[model samples]
Target: MAARDYGQYSGITRAMELVGERWALLIVRDLLVGPRRYGELGAGLPRIPSNILAARLKELQAAGIIRRAPRSRVIVYELTPYGRELEPVVLALGAWGFKALDEPREEQIITPDSMTMDLRTAFRPLVAAGLPATAYAARFGVAELLIRVEGGELDVSRGDGEADLAFAAGPDIRRLISGQLAPERAISTGVVEVLRGRGELLTRFASTFHIAA
Candidate 1:
């Protein structure tokens, strides 16, 4: 049984009952990045109450959205096939919410999994298809990412690597992706720092990864 019952019979209602809790969908979001151990999930969502995390895990498992599996002799939580189907829905939601995003609160923190999903949400495959293959090493706050675009495919992962462009930005990177800040303007205003590689590629990066805000 789910934690809430709306006394309605509908798909959206059922989904809300299953994953509408404060932290449930966030748990699913992180798991979408990859399998995570119990502690890893906790680390990713630093603000979640331990009891709430435990409860949500149990609820998600009961709803058939996730499962416990052994990897390297250690238990990890991963999305079930049914749960993986939520990827598109999550990405769409991220894009929708991005338009309203403002400055980060002092307590708000960026995690690698969250950044990875954000990139996935903003990736414009059609635009990238018209451009040459490019790689970008980016650091946002404490999270570092290596982003590669080849044709219509976008791949993002943690860590630094050789790339055509390297830059660091805080939350203001949103300004660039939203097209509110041109590459040159962003650089001059200190919204983004080009550490290596061609600075002009920041323009390409903006075009490749964008959300119309």
Candidate 2:
């Protein structure tokens, strides 16, 4: 599929022309983390129709934003170097959008990529620095995400392993990050389950990332 031509000389318009299609930027968002097979990408974007997803992928590939490569004898899609340069743009948009997250509505669904990217946008290195290095495995039923804070750096990845804490993603987790729900309440209410690691780690972990008010 061909991208729309905005016919505007502005760089912003040209950039938008490439990504303005529905699910285009979102596809890029999911690929920002790492290479993903078609199935993996579909998992992250459950709402997008398979046909639309395929079309968007074709458009992006043609535009040089992504490329297909063989990984472990299987094909996977990943962003090109030029595409990876959109990191700052994506993070900036994520940070700006946080203040609008008053409360998650019934219709609002949080995907693993959205959750992981939000953490990347919300991470406070100074706050993580004051706390001991920690790792967390967050499960969202559809997928599990690994978040690690070490030496004042934050890393978010797919898959799961041993961690300082683990919890199911839900309203309570959302509220906690937004500073609406307290850790104590989350535990007492059983909204978050501890699968491994010390309970105390949750407090420090909560402090490290916050959705903008």
Candidate RMSDs in Å, in order, are 0.9, 2.2
Q: Can you write out model 2's per-residue Cα lDDT over 1-213, one digit (the tens) per residue?
A: 456887779989878877789988888988887889999999888888999999999988988999999999999999999989888898888888776766567777777788788888878898888888888998865658899999889998878988879877564476777777788777777777777777767677679987746
Error of 1 at 58 (Å): 0.7
**What is the alpha-carbon lDDT for the whole of candidate 1?**
0.93
lDDT of 2: 0.82
Prediction 2 TM-score vs. true: 0.88
Model 1 lDDT tens row, 1-213? 457899899999999999998899899999999999999999999989999999999999999999999999999999999999999999999999999999888888788999999999999999999999999999999999999999899888889998999999988888999998998999999999999998999999999889989
What range of 10 consecutive residues in model 1 has the weakest lDDT sum? Answer: 1-10
lDDT of 1 at 147: 92
Pairs that collide in candidate 2 are none
Q: Rate the local accuracy (lDDT) of all candidates.
A: 0.93, 0.82
**Candidate 2 stretches greater than 4 Å from native:** 105-108
Q: Pick the candidate with the highest TM-score.
A: 1
